[model samples]
Target chain A: MNSRLQAWLLALPATFFVVVCLGLPVLSTLATTFGEPAGPFVTYIQFFTSGFRRAVLLRTIEVAVITTAISLVVGFATAWVVARSPGRIKSILIIAAVFPLLTSVVVRSFAWMVILGKNGIINKALLALGILNEPLSMLYTEGSVIVAMVYLFVPLMILTLVGVLEGIPQDLTDAAASLGAPPSAAFRQVVLPMAVPGLIVGAVLVFTGSFTSYATPQLLGGDRQTMMGTFLYQRAMVTFDWVGASTIAAVMVVVTIATVLLMSRLARKLNPVVG
Target chain B: MKTRIHPALIAFSVFTFVFLIGPLIIIIGTAVSDTTFLTFPPQGFSMRWFANIFEVSAFPRTMVTSFTLAVLATTLSLMVGVPAAYALARFRIELPKFLANVFVLPILVPEIVLGFSLLKSVATGVGASIWTSLLIGHALLVLPYCVRVVGASLNSFDFSVEEAAVSLGCPRWKAFFVVVLPNIRAGVIAAFILAFITSINDVSVSIFLTGPGISTLPIQLLAHMEQFFDPTIAAVSVLLMGVTVAVMTVVEWTLGLTFLTK
Candidate 1:
């Protein structure tokens, strides 16, 4: 066969898979938004106008931002430690970081329930210490959701940053030190600026992961805080409002894509190498 | 050549590691507990909860369904993704960026959105079964991973040997199967394992695609937890964790952990 024909022939199978399975479905879902009983713009209008949905959207953004910020800070520290460690210790730490990601989200979320439940570990200890008269209601709250999400996603940020941190030569820091720059100053001026790309990439991953995650918010937040994912679920499955659900789903996709673009642009502007 | 990790950083790292793995250790601990209610540090130990998994009829069946689906999805994705990766990597193709992005877009899209979209499409069809929906969904989900890993191997591959074989009157197809496939075999295998794990662990997409009387392992476990709130789910979680750890070990051995970060 001619190489072009051969190439298309080779690519046909996967292209068909994406087109039929993903492209068609996503387009159809977007199409459904226009067919809503109220009107074409009704679902979108209601979504933006409704206080409850606006709150959910804002809460999702808030939780995702906080989770990303916290994950980046903690993950950066973990990655720095792992990157600087000797071989055996490095392997152990890296494995510890990646191992949690191998388990199911349900499994991890359930694990958090055991740890953060009303009569769970922390509460049990607090009660034992006589810090409270009764077990505190920790589970099924926004705080629980954030904690569980950070636990679930921090590993990703760490993995991302570790690669970047490892790529930096030791001489750069040593040069700064020889010039009388303190350890903290070297990190702030030389290391942190160089790590911006990884930071941006990690932030995007953590933010999007936390924002779009359904299982974490569902089980941990319970019915208390309805994030976008949970709200989309209830609207689609429980209420059978596919049109309204599609509207939410489309909005989420747009927001996520926009965030990715924005973050990368910001990264490029901040990092001369990328720009 | 010489450096020391800061003491405070080491402390923080230890805490982070503990925070990441502690919940899982607690889950395993809870699974081994003899008590009915869930507890982190068990009062006593027994294998009853582990054995209790078999008592739940739906659990085993759902597990079988999930395993079958994962296997089928992984196989199908390899079949589709390998050739596509080859074309994208080797062919002097136009619009390569857009085509590659199309293959990878599923991962970029949120699972909740993907699931909802797939559900809408499946709903419009005439009497589609849950299995068909799930298989299609999962295959789409894992296709990107297959392409990615395979594409990476193909990128750094020496194309001269294949061309040399072709110059010696060897057919193109034979060159691919006899030479190209063997070299990229490790990448293909890594992709297969990653895809299988992804398919097995998926709950968000599965939740929407699953129909009456059909559920994946995660969904089944989630439903069971909603009602029971016992150690049985913990037992199941441990078993699932064991399988994942084993799969990840294979991935680490074959492809190395750095392959994922890259």
Candidate 2:
């Protein structure tokens, strides 16, 4: 076979699978949006105007962004410590990092509900310890949703960062330290720059996973959170508003694709790989 | 190894572990409690809940159904995903690299969306039962993992040997079956475990599509936990946790866990 034909034949199955299974389903979802409830324009108008739609859209984005940012910051510190630790401790810590992800999301999120609940351990302990005069309504707040999400994904951040950090040579840090550079200064100058690729990869994972996370926000947020996930379920299954849910789903896809493209463009601009 | 105690770092790591394992411990504690109500540091140790879990009629059937679904899904994923991996590896496919990204991109896509697509696909087109719909949905979800692992191995293998096998009297099927199969066996087993765990633990899509007649383990957990706060959920959680950790350990040892972590 000609190389062109061979290449095509090889790639065709994967391409076909993606198109039929993933791409078409999503497109069909969009089609449902248009085909149902007086077509696309009306659905778009309804989604934009409806209070539930606006609130859920705004809240989902807010929770996702805050979770990603916080996970990145904390994840950096945790990974840095573990990466530099001794062998046995390092493996132990790595296992701990991956532990959160291994547990079922339902189980993990359910655990958060108990811990963050009003009469649950955290609040009850605070009450007995006199930390708070009253049991705070910490359970179903935006803070709880963000906290649960960040907690759900911090291990992902640490594991990803370790991949980046392990690739960095110790000699550079030693060279900087020998040159009279302080520990912090060496990390900033030598370590941080070299680890940017891994950092970008980790950041992309945390961003995308958090952005699309449903159970964490849904189970934790309850009434107040009513995120796009909850809204999507409500519209599609419960309320049968496929048109509105599809609009929301399309919006999410656009946002995800746009952010990834933006980051790739920014990664080229940063040139952190060389620096 | 001469590092002094980094108190702040130690505390942070401990806190993360606590955050990770705290709920599980609490649920386990609750399940053993003597009190009828759900209470932590449960009133007194009792095996009654485990007994109660068995007494429930739907529990046994649900377990069998869930296990069957996961097995079928994993098997189907290996069948379809492995070849696609070989093709992508052996031949230069003239598609946007984005398609590869799209193919493997469904790791944690919001379940509601998958649920919607699945429901739409089944209800409208395939008109299949929930069992078939679930099998298909899960197979699609797990296919990417199989592709990733198989493709990783195939990419690293010596392709010239395979070409030689084909060039000789050996037929294409024999070349692939005899030559390439042995090379990617580790990946195939690893992918099977990963796919099985993923399908078994599946909840998001199950929640949406599960009719009264069908319920995955995770779906059943959601149902019980919603209706009654008891420690049986914890017992079940422990069982589920065991499977996940077992899979993770095997994946780590066999495939090198770093691939997934990275």
Candidate 3:
């Protein structure tokens, strides 16, 4: 086959899979926004006008922002530790880092519910200490959702960082230290620049995971906090406003694709291999 | 050449261990609560709720549903994804490298969007069925990870060995089967295990694709969680956690832990 034909032929099966599964609805779901003309745009108008959807979107953004920041901080510490640790401990820590990710998301969310719910472990401990007169309502709030997401996703960030960090030669850091650069200074100047691309993509991953996640918000958040995913689900499945649901799905799909593409471009500039 | 780890990093890693494993500890604790109602630090211990999972027919059926779907979908994804990945990686095609990226982007899209999209397409293309729709949907969900694992392996590969075999007067198919297949084994295994774990644990997609009579483990947990707050959920979670640990251990053993780092 001609190389171009070869390329297309090589890519065709996977492309077909993506086209049928991902590309199709991403295009079709937008039409769901227009609603049946014979019917009304009332669902679209209602969904947009509702302060509830606005609040949910805002909260989702807020949660995503917080998740990115916290996971970055904790993930950095974990990655740094794993990078510098002895081989045996490093392997053990790596296993620990990956365990949460391998488990079912639903299982982990329920694990959080047990940890955070009223009359759950944290509350009982607090009550025993007389710190609180009654068990606190910790579950079904914005906090639980973010915590679960961070716990679920931080390992991903750490993994990427470890890979990038390992690629950077240790000699550079040693040379910096030999020149009297402080340990902290060595990291700030020598390590961070090389690690920037990995960290940025990692940030995007954590951010997007939090933003689009449906189950985490539904199981963990209070009813008052409806994220876009939960919001889309309520519209399509619960309220049966197929169009409104489809509109939100379309917007979400576009946003997700655009964000990743934008990041990949920036990543390519940072590390040419990513392109 | 000396390579020594800093002790400060050890202290920091101790904290990492706590945050990662703490929730599992708390969940298992609550499962044995002696109270008539759920209690945090159980006044006493019992296996009542663990037994309760069996009493509730939903739990057993959900487990069966999750395993069946995971096995079927992972198998379908492997059959499709392996060849596509082979073609992309081994062949020196003139396509833009971005075609490779396009193959893997499905991993990043949220489950909710995927669920709705799959539902719409399946309904439109062929009336949604319990098996076919779920199979295709889960295959889509697992496809990207499989391709990435296999594709990365292919990119850094040595093609000369395969050519060496072809030049030895072996048939073309024999050259590919004998020379190329064995080399990319780790990546293929990684892809399969990832597909299996992901397909098994998925909730967002299953909730949409599943019918009234069909329910998966995550959805099973979701329904139980919605109506009641109890330790049974935790018992089930611990059970699930055991499976998670085992699968990950197997994957790490079979495919080196850093297999994807390449």
- TM-score each candidate: 0.97, 0.92, 0.92
Recovered share of real interface contacts in candidate 2? 0.37
List model 3 lDDT by residue over A83-172, tens digit each. Answer: 766779778878877887787788777777767877666887888899999888888788888888888888888887777777778798
For each candidate in the order shown, give its overall lDDT on alpha carbons: 0.89, 0.76, 0.78
Quality of candidate 3 docking, DockQ? 0.60
Check candidate 2 and list the clashing pairs. Answer: B31-B231
Worst 10-residue lDDT window, candidate 1 chain B: B120-129
Tens-digit lDDT track for model 2 on A178-215? Answer: 89998779878787777776667677777777777677
Runs off by more than 4 Å, candidate 1: B92-95
Give lDDT tens digits, candidate 1, residues A38-59.
7788888988999999999999
**What is candidate 2's TM-score against the reference?**
0.92
In candidate 2, what are the lDDT values of residues B1-262, reduced to their tens digit?
1444358877876776676667777877766787676667677788887777777767777888889998998887777778777767776454446545655756534445776787876645668788877887788788788888888888888888988998988887799999999988888888888788878877767777788878887778777877876667766776777777888788788776766655
Error of 1 at A224 (Å): 1.2
The most accurate candidate by DockQ is 1
Separate DockQ for every predicted complex: 0.76, 0.49, 0.60
Kept native contacts, fraction for each prediction: 0.77, 0.37, 0.63
